[model samples]
Target: MSLDQAAAVMEQQARACRNMAAPLYADLLVHTAEDVRAGGPCADAVAGWTGAPSTAAVPLRLLGGVHALVLTGQAPQLARFYPSAGGAYRPEDADAAWAAFRAVVADRRDAVRGWLRRPPQTNEVGRANLLLAGLLHAVQESRGLPVRLVELGASAGLNLRADRFRVAAPGFAWGPEDSPVRLPGAWRDGVPGWLREAARSYPELTVVERLGCDVTPLDPGSEDGALALRAYLWPEHTARATRLGGALELARRVPARVDRVGAAEFLAGLDPRPGTLTVVWHSVMRQYVPADEWARVTAELDRLAAAGAPFAHLLFEPYEQDGRHRFQLRARIGAGPERVLAEAHPHGLPAWTV
Candidate 1:
């Protein structure tokens, strides 16, 4: 691809970052876009890329790479501009911060390019809020049956331990008070009556099993794996970083296994047991799966449903509805029809009924 084309891709992602309240990444991305257009180090970092920009998330890959450099102490000059590294991004010092970021990309050119080869790996813990909500709905529908939780594209299997995380919203509260991962203000407007009642009725969840699949599963217990997860976080958002820290810490105490396999392959081997409710769930990772493979996944889900052995399918993914992109929490139980339980933020916060 031409340098100008790549630069445009960077600019597009910059707009996204701005919209998502990541001023640090937005500023860096905008400056990097200019560098790419000027055929500077940023251009070389993304040279010869030929995929749909949004699909590849090229800008995020590059920024995450640079963030890793700071986190790992490879680019100390850039660390001061990154909050995740105990530094701050000041609007008044934008030029100086850009200079530091540019220098890092130029010096660590190969490292930035290495990151471009891999897609962004962000297993956002905030999304667990929505997933847990769906799981609770599933449990309630299945009459308090012990759940066999299965996740597709669960990066670190962190959300597999969603049951253990503390969740609080208007008229709704659950999980251990002393839990490390605490999701507060979950529903923006007001807690849906159904969810509130479900939370009250169940009060606690019993997850008898936790298994997930990713093409390349990351071990949250490993130093490199944990660092990668942290590196991908936008430096300015301390809350996100804090939540991830807690999830990583919790991963050590919890036993959630993520196998290395395609989603369809993983689901193909499973069938619902009589006693436990098999809840198949995924969040934000649906776009990564190809349509044909997803067809297989749906087929597998249908097979489980037909088996009629206390099965549930839960999804917290984006959908085009009501003339806008909606991030929805949808669920179905046994042979029941699927329905949207609620709509939520992409990172799974502040949910409201559809």
Candidate 2:
């Protein structure tokens, strides 16, 4: 890279790392620079290098794009590359940080060309909800009772409508014969049906609370709120965008309201009412919560569990495994043992129960 090119890269890196503490950013930059030099995916993407390069540019650009879209809600020229339906270029419609990076590169022209040629894969939003349903079933089985779920990071609160919104795993062979979110396989057959039936048996099994916690909570009632929900979507997941729209409509119909609050503080104050089967569930929420806040949340939960609190908690997290994203389901009671219930695709296509 030329001196100017190197300087530009450094400047971008500095800005990207600014959110972290200064000391942390310095160390992170050093390690990240080394990782890029070693041909990491991050490095290649930013430098506009081609064919099996690093992905460093990816996170910065994507995150930046999301921020840009969230802030502006305007048409991004970068949308040409991603080509998502439903106003993908409009920042306010969806999360733009990732999308903006492409536009940012488009302006760069000289340095980021090669990297911008290919867009990152969309995170499968639909699959994520499917995994949550199975996790709910597993938790129900463990507790020996129907579950009343309370969700954190509810997003548009679509997953909370699992029963009402029809779903099918086109990629797998397990689920209802007539489903709305049709994918590529036969239904997982037995348990899913049983769970569905059980779900129906209790029409009055209301979600005591299907609330969410967002530093910036999204209220579907507002146009901007709808856009923020759009900004987070990856362009490749058309099905998800469709489903999100549907969920948004459902949310309007029932309006599953989310309480904007700190997760740790929220849980701390929540004394699950006696005899109520409360399941404190979080799906893909831990990553966003700050480390200190996360520690506090866990600590509070531990205190509740120690008291033999009448709550069954389920966590559905998608993490990288062998260069791919996969979901894991684990259940715990207060500080009790966290039992690993299943591991599957981040989307609901494939899953193996423990």
Candidate 3:
């Protein structure tokens, strides 16, 4: 993309990120802003979003007061535009202040756009869901009991513990006959029944093994990490934070077992025992891997499967430009076709049939 186009895209992304970030930091913006300005992934992330690398660093400091104002929930519109620590705009001039902020951003659009050019993560969740559902489906197809799952990008391992959550359908239906927590997401039209049947059919599913992969696994109970997690949430998504907090509680009690490893290489060396079905899965982790590494990973998996190794691969991933998250579940049983049992969502919420 041209520099200008790239800039626009960056600005667009910033706007979207703002929608998610504003609300998250409202409660602890003042305290967190200090943390944000201290220089870390969070600070870098905020700077990246604002598009002013030089001034980008400043936003982190402002985060404290700006977020505190938001948490107050009174005339937040003005607080959002003019942080409480004395600004050019008075609280009384709400509309004008917002307009002014927009104007400032518009003037700096080029620089901001340059920084916002990171790849989009839109269909990532959908892709993850698709792969997950397909893996379970494969187990049922084989009449296997008690599946084992190993995932990359465990992200608090929430999805890894998906079975523990109630998955529902449109007509107020649910899955896992005796699941504990209710999952939160919009299920596809027929997904509930399909999922329910999948569960019943795979009654043998014991989930003997479940683990995840991540460079840094966030702990909600940790005061420091909780702030970071909250900041990552979108301002418009209070419910998501609440859900995340709930997930955190579950995590503290029963966290996703994860192993730190390089994505493709890690899976390559992993050897599954005979008769014990080994599955390798990932959700939207491709973006993080370099092309060469991704190629190596693919080749490695192919070799293992070709050797007649008893293994399956599930990928719930998306191709962003098309806005489609295809579920691709491939299994190797004897010298047979690289079977694709199903394709669902990267995140499994609002899934589509492929």
Superposed by TM-score, candidate 1 places the C-alpha of residue 52 at a distance from the truth, in angstroms, of: 5.4
CA-only RMSD, every prediction? 1.3, 10.4, 8.8
The TM-score obtained by model 3 is 0.63
TM-score of each: 0.97, 0.60, 0.63
The order by descending lDDT is 1, 2, 3
Best-to-worst order by TM-score is: 1, 3, 2
Off by over 4 Å in 3: 1-6, 14-132, 171-181, 184-186, 192-196, 307-309, 320-347
The all-Cα superposition gives candidate 2 an RMSD in Å to the true structure of 10.4
lDDT of 1 by residue, 215-282 (tens): 97888999979988988889988898898999988999999989999999999999899989999999
Which candidate leads in lDDT? 1
Model 3: per-residue lDDT, tens digit, 1-354?
A: 322332344344444344444422332333233334454333443444544442222333333223333334433443444332223333355445544333333444443343344222111222334554666665765557456677876655655665554555555433445544444454554564445577566643566677776655544456744544543344444445455555555557655676656667567767666666667677766666768988988787676566654567666554544574354434444334655544443334556444
TM-score of 2: 0.60
- Score residue 245 of candidate 1 by CA lDDT: 90
Single out the weakest 10-residue window by summed lDDT for candidate 3.
118-127
